[model samples]
Target: MTDAILRMRGITKSFPAVKALQDVNLEVARGEIHAICGENGAGKSTLMKVLSGVHPYGDYSGEIEFDGEPCRFSGIRDSERRGIVIIHQELALSPYLSIAENIYLGNERRGRFGLIDWNRTNADAAALLERVGLRENPVTPAMDLGVGKQQLVEIAKALSKEVRLLILDEPTAALNDADSRHLLDLLRGLRADGITCVIISHKLNEIRSIADSTTILRDGRTIETLDMHGDGVSEDRIISGMVGRELGHRYPERVHDVGAEVFRIEDWTVHSPTQRDRVVVDGAALTLRRGEVVGLAGLMGAGRTELAMSVFGRSWGARIGGRVFKNGEEIRIRTVGDAIAHGLAYATEDRKTYGLNLIESITRNVSAAGLGKLAKAGWVNDNREYEVAERFRREMNIKAPSVLAPAGELSGGNQQKVVLSKWMFTDADVLILDEPTRGIDVGAKYEIYSIINTLAEQGRAVLVISSELPELIGICDRVYAMAAGRITGEVSRADATPERLMQYMTQTEEASP
Candidate 1:
């Protein structure tokens, strides 16, 4: 291993009524990829912010040393000036700008007389794009690229700064399997070029494959750091360290009888909203029984989410043709309000955008889906709303100062819980959770699983859509695999495995016309 390139000693940060980090210590060796693992709100992001100067120097107490020199960063620009760059989970590129413009956005090339140099800038951008394995034209607009290509643009932008220490926060959270593998390979190439990296991710498998060492944190405190190569570490051992306990079983035990089919969809077909003739969801059909936890597994763009959204309230696609049946009687859900009235609720995958109103307090967001239950004579009862929100907040174990806290301030896990709480408040009989545990830590995943089990035990039908096959096998009783906008196969929990599910996921793609 190389010598330590960055060291943060006795770092501490606090917010109002919350100590985000306390006595946190981190050390990263030069030319190595170090991972930071922790549950949501466990200070992983906070620590990174402190390092990248997002928290600034005076806002937190810490001793930072970079390349044997004591350094204090007053802002992100200050840190970037010293060869440090951070790419947040949300990509920071401007959609309207071209690739070359985004790469040299604030830091641009100048020709004679201090004017912009477009030719040299595009040529430099093309070279950087080639280095990052992105083949798109430098003049292509950022909005025209896919998520995977956009990620490459971010990395190219980072390289534009002559970055020495690169930090990636959940880089693969939004990528598909192929894109994820490509990104990992690119990280390896970066490491070969002698650039040290710090990656924050919930995907343990990716960490095991790419990281050299991992630092485990729990509740704002550093627990332990393990050498991935030398120690021969297993994922379970890392999970134990992050959660402070051994998880013998990935899923909680559930005891509930699956009753009659509570919800059913038949001959569902949704065409592309823009293309009109392109079919996004093709004749998909599914059923969920009361007290049953069913899973929909597929690759990204497999139409799982498209089918759910179309069925919920025709919220997606242009030409949608589907028949939904509740209690064996056909129902027409023409709008979101109609779907909610019919006891159907959808917990969206993108919680930041579609799930919660981030600017609003927890009280309002929790009661948002079920305002009619708390209204008196068309006037919302303020005290009733507060009481309901507070009850769900406590039940969901939301880590916040109070119910008045903004939904955006909480971590990813907490935000998901709030979304679940909002759906539960609606008293929906059938719940569709899309990528319910996508970006949360292992500990938070277990908590969310427990909540799903509790919902099943209460005789509510739950349908989950997830990309991780192991998660489906862990929490679901039955798994349905989708591919190319069709239901490819279904398996019982006793017969399901990652390999089996993956085969089903690709079966239709291989046979596509």
Candidate 2:
């Protein structure tokens, strides 16, 4: 602690209705990879924001010391000048701008005349991309790259600044396993280069592998900092500090009583919406039984989202060929309205974009999908809407001051709850949830799992698509694996394992003839 490169003491920040951070303390040693662990709304992000000047000096009462000098930063630029840079969980990049342009956006490279030097900018960007292990062209548009590569671009942007202390907020939350590994390796290399790093992540295994020490926070207060190499510092131990209780089981236990098949998709084939010649889903078939929680497992680009979107009223692809069956009766569903009319609901993975309206009030968002049920003569019953939203808010345990609050005001976990409540309000017989627990803490994930169990217990069919294998094995009664746009295999819960599911997920040939 004496050789700490950065120290924050007695940090307290508050908003209108809530006090976010309360006397939080943090210390990061020079060139060590330190991690911050906490549940959602636990003040981890707020503390980092306060340090990086997103909250500014006067907004929070705290003493910040960087490199043994007391500092008061009024803005993000002020912190950047002091060699501190932060990359938020939701990446901030201009999608239309080229990689070089995005990297040198505010910190532009200039020539003798103080005009932008395009040649130098691109060359420098290319070098930084290489340093981050991104083999992308500097002139390529930011939108052309996937989430993983975009993360690397964000890091390259940080490197553009002469950053001494790097702070990453859930950098690997959206990445696949391979991409997550590559980013972690890059962080290790950066640590070796004597650049201190503070990473906020929910992935405990990654923290154990990369971080030198970890600080746990709960309810806006610092719990404790533990040495990662200590004799008994395990993931469960970290969870204990984060949630303030011994988390006996990561997943809640559920009774499985799967019933008759209620929904089925047969001979499903979908071509890419942009690329007509490319097949995104080929002859994919799946079934959902009443009172069952089924899982769809796949790697990135394996067409899990594509299949779900396409089946939900052809919202994704073209040249779609599929037959929908409900109780042995073939039905036609060619639009979202039609799908909803047929008792189907889809909770998207990108909740910010596709699920709930951020600017809309919580009551409105909850009643949006089920307006017809609360409508009379094409006018929504505002009183009924409020009643329904309050019911869901209490049932789902969404933390908010009031149902009139905007959906955007809630944290990630609360926002996800709103999304689920939106779909649940529709009384759909079958629900397709894509990455339901993405970017949420372990405690929130358990709550989501319990909600899914409650849904199944109510005799609703549920299809869960996720990138995490353990999640599928833990809560699902049966799982289907996809690879190369084809269903490779299906396994019952009793027979499912990460290794076995991985074998099925990596297969190139279709499981079905």
Candidate 3:
């Protein structure tokens, strides 16, 4: 018998208009950690669905082999019975349920009285949670845990079914640096326990550290699966395989002369809504100049987001006390609408909730911010709206079926483009893009960088907030590091290495001697 644990041959999936997957093949050896590397909307998730039976047979043309025998998975349950479990990127867990209950939800230990045996369930859950490096009490509600802990709980839940093959899709995308490292360590432990693992992520650093082999996908086809355990494997080799071409530069070139200050903050402070005495943003003063992309760098909870939102209007925090100036003149921004009217637009980091109306069509979303301008006598000019949206659709290169496509149906990267287009239509001179490339793929990220550069060249003052230091270093002329609710230190792009930026980022005002 072959040593392969899972094999997918000639998988093909098509939608009404687009062929999502085209003749893809993959093989995972027993007890090996494999990674799926691809750009956004490159059929990586679709291939995973086919492997896990989410697509099922007849929906796609594919032959799947498990343990050297032919198998057919009609649904998620069918795949689960064979020890195949997949944990999605957006975690799926009951918030109200206790950790123990969530872990043993569907499969429970029932007594003679037809009631669940809580003792047995907790005992089993505790053991599994320990294996996943989660020490939280089993009785604690799942909602009380952070995203990292919740992800570990999901892993425990998957292991409760005694899974042999585990699939994780972008597991660390929502996690912080420490949590991401802990999760990767847990994956290594699972592999040592003889469980074969498959991970799909755009984070090449983590893949280089932990994966034994990686499969590269381009467009709708599998490029190749290179062995990382061998001597010839490297990130450059993997990147070439995934992109199908050599990259001359990782980041686009930036050339823009900084002009006079366009916007400024003086003695800004914000009190948390829940805790009145607690200050989230304290005396944070900064400035943005014309034709400049200034980077805001900080560890989580350093008030980077709070400062942006507070200045953009009273979009965040309570008891806001600040002085904002535009072109050296004071501006009254009491509401978000006022901020927009004053040539300011904020793009949130959490795009799904704060950045967009997901249920609306892309055309409506793009025109939502500019409706007043497009309206004539309290009636929207349909022809004008269509023309405006069509122009942006072409400019942004939004890969959608149509402008009338629901934003929810679009991919992560495309949705982001639409968000940018929304603000672009408003003709805002000062743009606050909070984590603009948070969840996008590499190719899309390059496009975003180019767009930012173009905006700067056009004399728009761009304020970019990013957690990824390398990103800020690449694009911004200057970067400010925040710590403990204040701007700590500013660095030039040439001097903005990860080490120097992180040192300023983690430093606090109340540090010990």
lDDT of 2 by residue, 1-513 (tens): 369999999999999989999999999999999999999999999999999999988999989999999999999999999999999998999999999999999999999889999999999999999999999999999999999999999999999999999999999999999999999999999999999999999999999999999999999999999989889999999999999999899999988988999999998999998999999998999999999999999989999999999999899999999799987799999999999999999999999998989999999999988899999999988999999999999999999999999999898889999999999998998999999999999999999999999999999999999999999999999999999899899999999999999998999998641
Query: lDDT of candidate 3?
Result: 0.89
User: What is the alpha-carbon RMSD of candidate 3 to the true structure?
Assistant: 1.9
Off by over 4 Å in 1: 509-513
lDDT at 314 for candidate 3?
87
Per-prediction TM-score, please? 0.98, 0.99, 0.97
Q: Put down candidate 1 lDDT per residue, 1-513, tens digits, no spaces.
A: 559999999999999879999999999999999999998888998999999999999999979999989989999999999999999999998999999999999999999999999999999999999999999999999999998999999999999999999999999999999999999999999999999999999999999999999999999999998999976599899999989899998888888689999999999999999999999898888899999999999988889999999888999888899789999999999999999999999999999999999999999999999999999899999999999999998899988889999999999999999999999999998999999998998888888999999999899999999998888998898998889998888899899999988888987653321
Where does candidate 3 stray beyond 4 Å? Answer: 510-513
Better of 2 and 3 by TM-score: 2
With a 3 Å backbone cut-off (N, CA, C), the pairs that clash in candidate 3 are none
Clashes of each: 0, 0, 0
| Local distance difference test, each candidate | 0.93, 0.95, 0.89
Q: How accurate locally is residue 411 in candidate 2, as Cα lDDT from 0 to 100?
A: 83
Q: Which candidate comes out best when scored by TM-score?
A: 2
lDDT of 1 at 493: 89
Residue 92 shift from truth in candidate 1, angstroms: 0.6
